[model samples]
Target: MTTGSATLSAATRRSVLLLSFATFASMAAQRICDAMLPELSRTFSVSLAQAAQVVSVFAVVYGLAQLFYGPLGDRRSKFGIVTFATLSCCAGSLMSAFAVSLDMLVLARVMVALGAAAIIPLSMAWIGDTVAYELRQETLARVGLGTTLGIVCGQLVGGLLSDTLGWRWAFGLMTLLFGVVGSLLFIDRRRQQAERLPTTNTEPVVRPGFVAQALIIITGPWSRIVLGVAFVEGAAGFGVLAIWASHLHQALGLSLSAAGAIVALFGLGGMLYMVVARQLIRRLGEQGLTLLGGSLMGLSALVLGFTPHWLLSLPACLLAGFGFFMFHNTMQTNATQMAPKARGTGVSLFASALFMGQSVGVLLAAGLVDRIGSGAVIALGGGVLVSIGIFFARALRRREELMRLQ
Candidate 1:
């Protein structure tokens, strides 16, 4: 290989790695907050519903902020945007550590969520610019692993630290990590800029029609169906875990730590799907995989709903987790392919749908748990997922036929 080409490749690899780490670490903060909420609620003498606002506010702000970040990445420097976002996360984490009231804590979580939300879109966009389409899934798979592993680590670490040292220390340590990592990345970026030559008359690599691209993904050919599946799939997987610790504690007499571990196992299923999804995609195609994933999620939810046994529910959780990711990944992968011109906006729109689904899922589950029961609420989610999948299958078939005609 040529020396300059090899150097460029190495630089790109390093950048992707740094961004991936930043993304994983930022996301870890999200779930860890869940573990801390109960403690905060007790300290502030707030109801569980009131304390849950911490997560609710974070999810909403995080999803909404992506709309801004996608355009920022297109207009400004990605490295600068990432560094700035990480700084915000660091500030939020430190502030939350010292928060004296539930209101202050919820505000702090919003800061962290807003800061961390920028990482994924920027990283994925950066990767899209660097990698070819054919090999993108392998790279995406690697990034997906980072996200899922972060979920697992967040649960395990949040519970363990909250149990051993106290919840405040979790936020404190996260603040330290964010501060250190953000500083290091900023320094590295400066060093790279100093060493590299400035190019003259460079054109914008990302297209200007990012908003249109976002709309297309949000409202395109069978886009609603695809996004609907993404939402339901996200709700079934993310919604359950978001509320499950309390549900298990109330229904089956599980401790928070034990529940966290069980949730960690469920996350492992997603990690496993990330590891093997490329092969599955190659063999099944997107539609087939979505159907298979949706069906499994439906079956798992049904099992969890009807069985009432923890052991049985465990495997059901695993299947549901795996199915959730498989289906969600299909939509995201397709979205990325859909608008290569505005990849950041496209993927961000996809994330917006998924997160929106999650917010609704958690809120809906929380409300329904008292009236319909956890089992029935989850079964309802599973039913929605299955219906979305069936619809998606038909839509994909029509798209394929149109492609043949074209």
Candidate 2:
């Protein structure tokens, strides 16, 4: 490759790495809260419901922020906006460490979520700006490694710290990491600003016609499909996993360490998929890969739901992880490509869909588990996921065929 191309590639890699690390750190901090919540509730003398507001509010804020961050990123320097938001996350984490009451902790969680909400979608948008569509899926899988890796570390580290040092220390350590990362990013942003020579008579881009833009993106035919697919994907594996963590502990009477280790294995499975999804995507194309991904996830979920054995669950978790990423990576790539002008917005919507689906799934799983037990609830979710996957796969295939015919 030429020098300029090589330099561009290197710069892109650096930026993507930074973005991914930020995601890793943010996700780590957020997820640790779940493990730490029981301790926090006891310490603060609050009910579980009150303490859970920390998670609920954070999730809501995280989803809503994506709607704004997209347009915001479009109008400004993605690096600057992302860095600023991440710093906010650092501040929130620090505050969470020192929170004196349940309400205070919930507020801090919201702040952290708001800050973290920008990282992934902005990263995808920036990548879309820099990378071609042909390579975007694989590139995205690499970036998504942060999501799985962070989850693995968070479950492991958070459980250890909470068990030994106390839950507060887990939050404190995460706070420190976020602070250090934010400082580095702040310095990088300053350097980039200094290097960019100013140009005169620029219009200074701003969000244009917010209502109309929102309508156009949200009302498109593909938007529903994209949103539905995202919802099913999130509700399928992510929701199931969240419930699975607790189920393993309650039903099997496993210790925290054992449960965390099993959960971490799911991350390992995801990492494997990340390594290979791009190559597979190239060979299978988006439609074929998505179909395979969905089927595997459905089958895996079914296996886990029915087996009731820890060893059996592990393989199922691996398959679910692999399928989840394949489907997820394709949707993300398509989201970015759906709108060239508002790539960030499209991606943010995609993120919103996925998270919203997870939220719905969590609620549904909770209700279903109460009525029918965790095993049956999980199996039902798996069946629902399979149905959604089949619908999307067929649609994508038909679309491809029509394009060819035309």
Candidate 3:
């Protein structure tokens, strides 16, 4: 597609919306297990720690699966891969709802994660293919509404389903959602294939070998830097956020549901950014947004770390959410362009680095939280995030200058 300021075609808009819904389902599946750990423990007569393996296993599988999907997306139809993945998610969710043991549940979750892995990064690659760089950020922000809402709703929906209907019903609901969305996307894919087959004006397809594409992304200095920063950003930023609910409950005696609601405010803040994305880009640009985002996140972390009352977490979470998306969205825009020839592989590696970073950060936090306390750990994360923002902002400036010179 050509880069232009023209309005998005109706079909493109529909595809984005459908992909957004698919993303929502995927994200919701990721978090739904968090609120249901106690239930899982009870159902299987296992320790809470043992039950937590469901979440851990899913994350590991999800992160690793991105490596396969990234190169496959480059060679196959991006939409086709995403649709098949969604069907896999639906099957996995159904299996989870009927799992007979903790081991079975864990296996089912791994299947779900395997499928969920492809939706976001590949959808992002699709956006990169169809949208212009200048307009891509806004398009991404708009699409982010689905993801943000999914994050916000996941805990609530999971908790509610677990409490009222039973945790199994939660998975059943997801199974239904995945089935519906997957069917719609499958139909859309058929339509796209039909439209393209008759066209003599179809664009030439690039089929770079998987190993070659991977090498292209890994060998580039700029791409390596982008991936590295994404890894650290995930670790330092999301790692702290991960423990917020536990900290609130342990430190301030807030109920689990209340603490989760406070964390959901972070998603609300992201939604706020999407509403004003166009104007924000015009006013702040990428570098300014990065600086502002990091500062806000650092401030929010400090606030959360030291707050005497639980209410303070409300605004703190909001600031952190807004800051995260500003910084993250900027990184995402850069990742899409880092290796335009191998955009899918580049973005997939970026995502893999990010998830791996989150896993590392969580491990580190788990080790330190007992000794230093959650408050100190969060404060440290804030400091690191600020440093990252500063470094990346300067790097982006240098990158822009180099491009202009070229």
Q: How accurate is candidate 1 locally (lDDT)?
A: 0.70
**Considering TM-score, which of the candidate structures 1 and 2 is the better prediction for this target?**
2
Q: For model 2, give the 10-residue run with minimal summed lDDT.
A: 197-206
Cα RMSD, each candidate: 4.2, 4.1, 3.0
Clashes of each: 0, 0, 0
Q: Which whole-number lDDT from 0 to 100 does residue 32 have in model 3?
A: 73
- Tens-digit lDDT string for candidate 3 (19-102): 988888887887776656656778899865567667666766777888899888877788889998998898899999999999
Candidate 1 residue-wise lDDT, 366-398, digit = tens: 778778887787688788888777777677778
- What are the runs in model 3 whose C-alpha is more than 4 Å off? 37-51, 162-164, 197-206, 400-406
**lDDT tens digits, residue span 1-406, model 2:** 0112222355466666777777778768656755554555678887544555665566667778888887877777777777888777877887887888888888888888888888878878777766665666777787889877877777766656666877667778877777777777777778667765222113233466555556667776666577668877777656555566555655676665566667666677778888887578878887877788788878887787777578888888778777877777778877776556666777788787776776666666766776788778778877877787778777676654433332
Cα lDDT computed for each candidate against the true fold? 0.70, 0.71, 0.79
* Residue-pair clashes, model 1: 0
**What's the lDDT for residue 41 in model 2?**
62
What lDDT score goes with residue 52 in model 3? 64
